[model samples]
Target chain A: MSVLVFIDHSAGQIKKSSLEALCYGAALAASTGTTAEGILLGTVSQDLSELGCYGIGKIHQVASDTLNNLDARVFSTVLAEAVRSTGANIIVFSNNLSGKAIAPRLSARLKAGLVSGAIDLPQVANGFTVRKTVFSGKAFANVSIHTEIKIITLNQNAFPLTAGQGTAQVIPLDIKAAAPDVKTVSATQSSGQVPLTEAEIVVSGGRGLKGPENWGMVEELARVLGAATACSRPVADAHWRPHNEHVGQTGIAIAPNLYIAIGISGAIQHLAGVNRSKVIVVINQDPEAPFFKAADYGIVGDAFVVVPKIIEAVKQLKGVA
Target chain B: MKILVCISKTPDTTAKIAFKDNNTKFVAEGVQWIINPYDEWYALVRAIELKEKDPATILHLVCVGLPDADPVIRKALALGGDEAIRVNADSQDSYYIAAQIAAVAREGNYDLIFTGKETIDYNGASIGGMVSELLDLPFISLATKFELAGSLATVTREIEGGEQTEQVGLPLVVSCQKGMAEQRIPNMKGIMGARSRPLKVVEPVTADTLTSVVSFELPPAKAGVKLVSADNPAELVRLLHEEAKVF
Candidate 1:
């Protein structure tokens, strides 16, 4: 029996979360004394074998044009068939949007015990048991799976990426493709300088930016840091930024490695979506901003003056100019 | 359209979380239970929206809980749902809950199933997807905006860096999040109508469960915040390096 990892991708490119899941799956397989393999759906130009550096032994590709876009039902059905065909006892996926949609379906199809938002590998001294976060990252629960097969969706940033020296065997799977009941006629992609979810660092502003015209400093700092830009709900609601850029309980949730918030009071609703960041630096002029309570680092200074200085410092530190 | 909305009772967001019985279970002494916030925002609001679009549409509310959960179910009915179903079995696991929901959906012949992106209580976000798999239907999650035209439904979801819009056929499952629809307060008429609506309580069909919760535990207490004077931003940086050691 093998461990199967689903590689999430879009528009012919793999997502960073996929790599994190790959490492997680590889580690789990090591503990269980089983080989870790991966399954890639759709067509991508990236070399699948190169990802073997993540410590997988084999990579299975089902390169079909129809599989380019995500269709949860179709992907789950195909993956279920792949599990049976490859004799995989464990399946792994990143706990992102696609993974969240597909993991449960795959579990029901395979009758495997499933865990979502898992923070660590199963404690496998006895029967397999995985620990996951509950209550929106507030608490922990240990769940033991009694089934013969198991599935887990690892939360992104929960596990650090580990690299090894090896190339995986890229074997193309020959399985009958299932037709998708859904069809995508058109997709409206968000046009932005940085993609929020994939960015290593994100510089977000809140009402503290004052108005849309005063956003220049925030943008300058974000550009210097090579980070994506975002806003709180009030900024979005005020139309200072698009609603899509809002990151809060009512907006997109993100967990970047470095999250810098400028001029925003962190409401609980705002905190709910972004509390998972690795390092949070809140740069608000308000020392009393509730976000300061959660920040790992805080700079109580005016964004207008402080952000520009930080940008200059970063550029000098990087020796860019 | 026949839409089924799933709701779960959860602790209020502000409730102080604690553990009892050697940290094996949550302490329930003084906490108040309400409809899961996300479930209320997505499932309840979206159901109301659909009902408004088509007055003939039927909206059913379902939950997996004991008889005491009837008040929560009635609250959902008052929120404009037409009928209610409470699976008599207490949900011991996510799989069992999904099975109960799938059973009801299949029996009711629901064309669409609406659930919150995830319950605030467990935050598993697994039931909607599991039920979709069981029923062999398409599942879309974290939908911000959705519109149904004829037999096709288009949904917009927020992905890592961008947004994706997908169009799928009928008989679909969608896990709703914020922005899918606006929140609504139930009218007095709707509240009165809810009191008279038929709430069918049924036992869940037996299904294989793969997992069980062994224990629950509170997270370790966070170290008290270390504050630096505003004049010394560099001191703040030093604290991150030395005191917190998290930078």
Candidate 2:
């Protein structure tokens, strides 16, 4: 049995989350006495040999420009073929936007038991049991996969990355790529913005920031820290921020390394999305704020008075002008 | 056009979460349940908006669970669904739930099948994709905007650092999120009208669940917050940089 990790890339470079998935898959393969292999669907600019440092023995490249647009059906079909050709019993993907789109379809197509948002490797002593976060990160569930071939999507930053001195053998994967029924119309992209889903440090604001005009400090803090900017649902609804920047149960759920919530009253809807962050900092004036219950650190202060100082301190720490 | 909006009953957003049966089961007693926010604000509401634009379009609601989920179905109908179907089964397994929904959609011949990005209770965003694959139909997940014209449908979905707009023919599946539509509350008239609407209960399609839950556990409670006095705001920064190590 072999383990295959899907390498999701954009603009010729591999994603940080994909590297986490590779390390997780490689460790699982080692624990099971199997070799880890990787599959790259679209054309890549990075050398395939760099993947060997993550413990992958072989790298399968299906170099095609058509695969770059990220049609879920086409990707799943191509990935299913690669899995079959590589004799992989277990397939792994980072639970990002691309993985979320393709993993379920691949699971249904290959009749493989799938566990998305898995937090840890599976236990092999008995049947393969995977631990995953459920109920919007409020609870954990141990799910046992009973299928012959298993598929797992690891949550971003859930595993440690191992960099070793090695290189993998790259091979060409031959497969019949079919066009999806869905046709692309147009793409409106915001270039150079860190995606909220993949952000390590996120500085978010809410209605307490008062209005869109006062958002400069939040953005400044984010800029100084090289973090992504997010907003609460109310802020997005009131047009203080774009809908894509909203983070909550009804919005985009994110799990970053450091989540700095400024001026946002910690509502349950918002907490469900960001509670998985490794460190949480809530900056609100009210001591009774519900968000303080979940925060690793808290500050009782006014956002207008507090954010500027925080941004200045960040600049000082980074020695930026 | 016929649209079937998938809905799920979940614990209220503020419900205090706890486990029972030695942490194997969720405690449901005393907890109020509501229609999942994504389903209400995006999938079901978008379908309602479509119906309002074109009166000929029919909106139906489907849920996979026991009778306890009917109230959530009724809530959907009052908001705008014309009818409802409750598949009598436990929805803990996403694969089995998708199979049942696929069976219902096949018989109903829905032109459009819509679901939320995922259910809040399980956070398993797998049903729509699995159902689409099972029925051999095209699926789009997390569509922010869906517009239908004749036989073609335009779906705008958010991707990494961008938004992707795609066009697909009818008889496609989509899971929606925010930006699709605004939330609609049921008026008294609509609530009374929903009481008279048709709610059909159908048996589930027999299938082996690929994954079974062994147990459930609450996430470890966060440590007590170390409050930094607001008088010295820079102190918060120092804490984040030193003790927290977030930077």
Candidate 3:
């Protein structure tokens, strides 16, 4: 029996979270005395063989044009069948949108013990136990799964990717496709420089930005750093930024590597989503902002002046003209 | 359109978070329990919107709690819900709560189930997903906006750095978030009307629980903030590199 890793893709390219999940699954498989394989659904344009560097021995590609879109039920059904066919004893996924939708259903279907938001490798001393964040990253919980098959959804940025010199065997798999009951009529997207969830660095603005017109510096800095842009809930509600850019308790919960908050007094609601960041930097002229209490680093400054200078310096550092 | 909106009764946001006599349980003395704020935004408001589109639509507010939560359930009824259901059971675990809701959904023959992305109290975003699994239906979490037309529902969810639009068929579960609708306060007329609406309290069937919380504790306090001079932006950057090691 082997460990199965689900590779997430969008716009015909694989996601960085998938690579992290692949490495996590590979490491878990090694500890469990089993081999790790990967499954790629939909039509991917990337070189599937290159995934071998993460220690994946083979890739099962379900190359169907219809599979490009997401239908949780359909995806769960197809993935369950794939697991049975491959004799995979453990299933792994990135603790993401698709993973959140599919893993629970798959767990119930297969009667396998499941865990999400797993932050570390499983402890196999006596029984298989995995560590996960609970209470909105406020604390950690150790959960032990006592099923014949195990499933885990790794949190984003929780595990680092491993690179090595090897080529993985890309073996295509034949699976039955189910008809999706849902159809997309129109999709409205927010055009931006960085994808917030995938960005290594995030530059967020809050009420301190003052008005929508003053957002240029935040965008310029994010652009220079190749980081995604985010806003506190109040900023989004005021329409300074689109609703999709809102990151907080009521908004999108994120766990990027570096999170920089500007002009924002961190509320408990706002902190719930971003407290998981590896390093948090708060920039607010008010030295007493609550955000500074939780920030790993704090800079007392005015965004209007400090942001422009930071952007210019970043551009100069990156030599991006 | 029949919509089932689920709300959880919890302590008010302003309530002081603390432990009880032995620092094991949440302090509940004199704490006012209100409908979870997130659920009100994502579920109740969206349900009202659906009702406005189709006046014939049936909107039911549901909760799994004891009799003391009836006032909050009545408050939900006053907020335009035609009916309310009290499961008469404490939501001890996610699995048990999901089983109770799944049973109710099956019996009601509801087409769509709506809940907050996660309850502020338990914060177990698990029920909606688990309920969908038990009911054998599609589930979507953290939907910023959703539109239902011609038996197909399209939902947009915020992902890490980006957003994704998903289309799913009818008879699905959706966990609503901000942007679904603005919070609505109950008017005097609605409050009077709620007095006569049907509020049913039923006992919950015993469900097999797979997990239990052995203890609870508060998160450790964050370290004190280190202030950096704003005059030298370069100094701040240097400190991030040499001291914080984050750069």
Indicate the residue-level lDDT of A184 in model 2: 89
lDDT of 1 by residue, A221-251 (tens): 7787778899998998788997778887657
Q: By summed lDDT, which 10 consecutive residues of candidate 3 chain A come out lowest?
A: A181-190
TM-score rank, highest first? 2, 1, 3
Clashing pairs in 1: A197-B160
Clashes of each: 1, 0, 5
What is the C-alpha lDDT profile of model 2 across A100-208, one tens digit per residue?
8889989988989999999998999999999998888888999989999999999987887779878999999988789878888998877777888888999999888
Q: Which residue runs of candidate 3 sit more than 4 Å off their true CA positions? A: A190-192, B10-33, B68-71, B91-93, B121-124, B150-154, B157-169, B211-221
Model 1 chain A is weakest, by summed lDDT over 10 consecutive residues, at A312-321
Show where candidate 1 strays beyond 4 Å.
A237-239, B226-247
Top candidate on lDDT is 2
Per-residue lDDT of model 3, residues A190-276, tens digit only: 566667766778999999888999888888877877788899999998888988788876677788878999998998878878988
Which one wins on TM-score?
Answer: 2
Candidate 1 per-residue lDDT over residues B1-247, each given as its tens digit: 8999999988777666788888778887798887887788777888788789899898889999998788888878888888999999875578889999999999999999999998876878889889998898889888888899977998887676666778888899999887777667778998899999999999879987789888887666444345555555556545544664533
Reference A-B contact fraction recovered by candidate 2:
0.75
| lDDT (Cα atoms) of all candidates against the true structure | 0.83, 0.89, 0.81
- lDDT-based ranking: 2, 1, 3
Candidates, DockQ? 0.57, 0.77, 0.43
Candidate 2's error at A177, in angstroms?
Answer: 0.8
